[model samples]
Target: MRRRRTYRLTGGLAAAGLVLLGIPPAAAQEQGGLETQLRFSQRLTQEDGTLSTTTGLGVTLSSRTRTEAFLFSVDSGLEQDFDGSALQQKDPRLILSYSRESLSSALAADFSYRQSDVDALSEDDDISDGVLRLDEGLLKRYSGNLSLQLGRDAPFGGTVDLGYSAKTYSETSDPDLLDEESVNATVALRFDLDPRISAGLRSSFSQTDRDDPGQDTDSASIGGTLDFGVTKTLSTNAYLGYSRVTKSTPGFPEDVQKGLAYTLSFTELRPNGDLSGSLGSDIDEAGRRTTARLDRSLELPSGALRAGVGLSTSEDDDLRPLLSFSYDRGLKRGTFGVKLDQAFSTDSDGEEALNSDFRVTYRQELTPLSSLQAGVVLRDTDFVDDANTDSRKLQLDLVYRHALAEDWNLVGGYSHSISDKSDEDRDHSSKVFIGLEKATRWRF
Candidate 1:
């Protein structure tokens, strides 16, 4: 799977082209809407006894048709220190996204180019999903996904899913965080043996490529699935499969791992919610891994709740616990929510790491034309193989908005961030900002 680096923009372009072609010119000329927004802001930040001010501008344009949508946005800013230093660019971001959907298929494509001084990853961004570096710099990313269903109205049907993602860093010295590409595809064919029973065959393949040979890896699997309706509200599924994983390194021999894979799962539909549980084992470059999990969702008259718990073990014989819980409620004039989750994932180096995340959010209407929102998030990570790399991060945000007139609003916010690393000293920063935003929309 290891190969020399080559930048490929064909896949991204094709995805966009397909979406454009899928939209009929007649439809595009018919019903459509566009929205444009502009923002001007000034911020004051204090960090470690140093003060700075930043001025920023942002613009956004979006359009949507019956079956197609497009978005583009850009944000730029310049900062100056109180010590008479010249203004310097802080961080800038440009983003574009396109999506198209039909009765039997859906397509989504996104591209982002951003510069930052901190880690390029976000709270929801997975290091395992793309090529990412531990350090921060200019980053460009592209991703596209497509899903199709064959014979939508027929009893015998199948599904096909394809996804691709790539990442590249600009002017980076780190070999691990350079150019990277990933692709995955899955296909399934099903036949309805009867009204209560169905069987299917599935195959999947995924690969991640990077400049570093040690990080290049691929996995493939083929499986058979059986679905049975035990009752009107209960169903069960069983999958039996074989999987293989391969990895390459500079000095070590190519590692080819193979193993049997299987999963048994059940789902029960309740009056107000649902319950699901699954047990499975899969092979990876590291070795064979097994997991068991149960999840439940509950719907209340004014709120909702979801929870899950699981346990997993790998070839190393190390056991790890997984958990997730979330609750959200609507108030007369506000909303409140809390969430907590812990799960196992791999870093860019292909080493498994456990991550724990907790968040709380609240929003309230303070006046007829004003609102307030607040949120707090905490994240912790522990490397299974390297304890010295464990780290914790915290973020606090508060924002207030008041309508000034039609399509105009006054916005202010405060943000605080802190990071604690086992191998580095603690770091923290705080910022306060106020901005004016104007938005307009047109329909045709």
Candidate 2:
């Protein structure tokens, strides 16, 4: 197991100083607030004919001064399985920010931190080139940004921004899985050219280090952007840049790559919604890649619709297409929604894969204080190079909620899921949960 030294202490201390400086005596005497919630539930799984109990608790604290804001929250849970095994999960988050504006200048700083599960696949995991799987490993991330504007009220005003971010993952059951550490820094300077146009120059550097097998990569890019509004409803942005990347792997040759990068985008803000499109190309350790995307959204009287399409060519010269659509409607006494998505991409190993998902949900108001909701989701994944390694999943859920009081509620839900994999046995699982939830808030 490997770990990186924590770097959040400096930002934390700076935020604390800002809080103290920004809060006046009168503001400090004013009230801050805290909110808390707790729930307990029981679950059943049909695959192994097992029952489990779960409990969750959450709390949030928030405060704001005349020129600063602060928020802290924590969520923790424990699950006890029928087999006598217990799983514990905890997520804690913090946000702190300060902003000040004077006659000629403005300054702002923001910092955030979070610890949670690795919820999705990341590009940095490509070293394994393995099939994507659900990982329950804990992940910690920290980020901060600061911006300063000079001559803010002037037509030729300029703004400078600096940012840093880092992420780490741990607590994996699989010894083969590698822990990751990464840090990123970016700086940008922009000048207002006109009332409807601006220009900016940006530079960024990042490094990612992985343990098992020991790999490290460093990347840097410098770019310029031009933003202009063609009309009140239309606008365009253009960018040109160059990037340099270097990677060192145990078994692979050390390589340094450099290439040009550019992007052009257009956006239309319609009365009802908006439409946008973009095309971009860049080079990195994985080689040169190009991508294009288009998105549109519209609002109806009682509903909303959104759709998007994307296409990209990977370093391996594989072309992948992505499509997605979603629609939601609110009825007099109910709500309905549907979503569909199809995505194609490469796994960590640069192997092409396709993933598709479809979901439908409906909710009906049974009474003024109660509601019934149901949903179904289907997912499919296919590996292009390994057709026999395909997988599919189907899930169904029904939930009922009743308001008991202004701060109390009763919740019950049932869920069932089935998963099928090529050359593997099918797995079926189900759970039923009934719980009373209480929420409380205080100001002091």
Candidate 3:
């Protein structure tokens, strides 16, 4: 029921800005549509043996056209203890998103803003970094992206892309919640000598800034790319480049590294699937890095499967394994999916960590107007710089929905989660909730 006042104001202003941006002269002339939904709910939660109840309201608005779209949603309410005392605002949340794309050219832009609280086993909430925190806090996220291409079908063409993202957290004891921001841009030009062969030049720049001054870093690179068709269904791409990275930490001398970077990759297309493999080496703030991976995707009669495996080695570490796998199957009046991924990744603070995630989900249609959904998620994180900072998390969710009438539905769910860290006691949380939801849509 606690929140950051500053972040709330920022989210409100951002939402207003996006709404204003959604209404341009071009969009005003095109066919547009609007959809709204409202939900009222009551939830009961038990955290570490303490019980509380919440009554909440949720609202969503969506507008869209052929080339542009906008969405805004918010949830807020009041909560109290079993004794009906200590009433406070429910953990409030707000999200705003907008996207636009040019129909004639390869031009697109996307922007999104989110403000939410990090609570144990909360519904409709997710941590951006995917690492569960042992404590609770407020998190705000902002991101924007733009990309465009010139002369996509010409012998000579070019493309440009830009991206930015920032994540900030307040009122939390979690060590991994340090605020961070990143910016990236890339430009490329290509010329086609023949239908099956082309060459291009590319330049890119990226920067990562963190609340920890020691983690701030920037890098830039220039490269040449060649695409060759080996056969009708086979192709190869090669890149040769030079890159430089600089790290500046307070009270310490600046560190700079420059080196040659290169990559070789190939792809083969099959009747119903494809296979690809790549090997690359690069230099960054983390140090010199080399990696190789192979991936394959296949379409089955009633399902699909995709998997990948790789190995990565850095200047200061031995070879480490990486894996990715996902499978989805269609059943009679139902669907099921499984996913698993294990790789070296960076946390919100730009620190290196090993992440392993596994998830399984299932949905079944109980009747024409009723359905059931269930999921299980398991996650593990190990800091590369410290041995005592490992953590594991497990969560289970089950929900059932039944239509009561037109534009009305009944919803009930149960959720449980446990967090186990090497340096802290296990944290457990669970919740049960039932609610009614109504939705309507119209176009102008």
Reference-based lDDT, each prediction: 0.68, 0.62, 0.70
> Residues 53-84, candidate 1, lDDT per residue (tens digit)?
66666667677788888877776667777878
Model 2, C-alpha of 343: deviation from truth (Å): 6.7
Misplaced by over 4 Å in model 3 are 1-104, 117-133, 348-350, 386-388
- What is candidate 2's TM-score against the reference? 0.74
Model 2 alpha-carbon drift over 4 Å, by segment = 1-47, 63-69, 81-131, 135-176, 340-359, 377-394, 420-426
Question: Of the pair 2 and 3, which is ahead by lDDT?
Answer: 3
> Can you write out model 3's per-residue Cα lDDT over 1-444, one digit (the tens) per residue?
532211111101111001111112233433576766565655555444456665666666777778777767666666677755678764455556666656335666666665555533322223224455556777777888888888677889898999998878877887757788889999999989899999999999999888765367899999999999989999999999999998876667888999999999999999989999999999877678799999999999999999999998887678889888999999999999888777666555445666777778888899999988787777777766774367787877777778897766676666667778864578666655555555553444
Model 2: per-residue Cα lDDT over 16-61, one tens digit each: 0001001122224334343222323232222235555545555555
Clash counts for all predictions = 0, 2, 0
Per-candidate TM-score against the hidden true structure: 0.80, 0.74, 0.82
What lDDT score is found at residue 141 in candidate 3?
72
TM-score comparison, 1 vs 3, better candidate: 3
Candidate 2 lDDT (Cα, 0 to 1): 0.62
Error of 3 at 389 (Å): 0.9
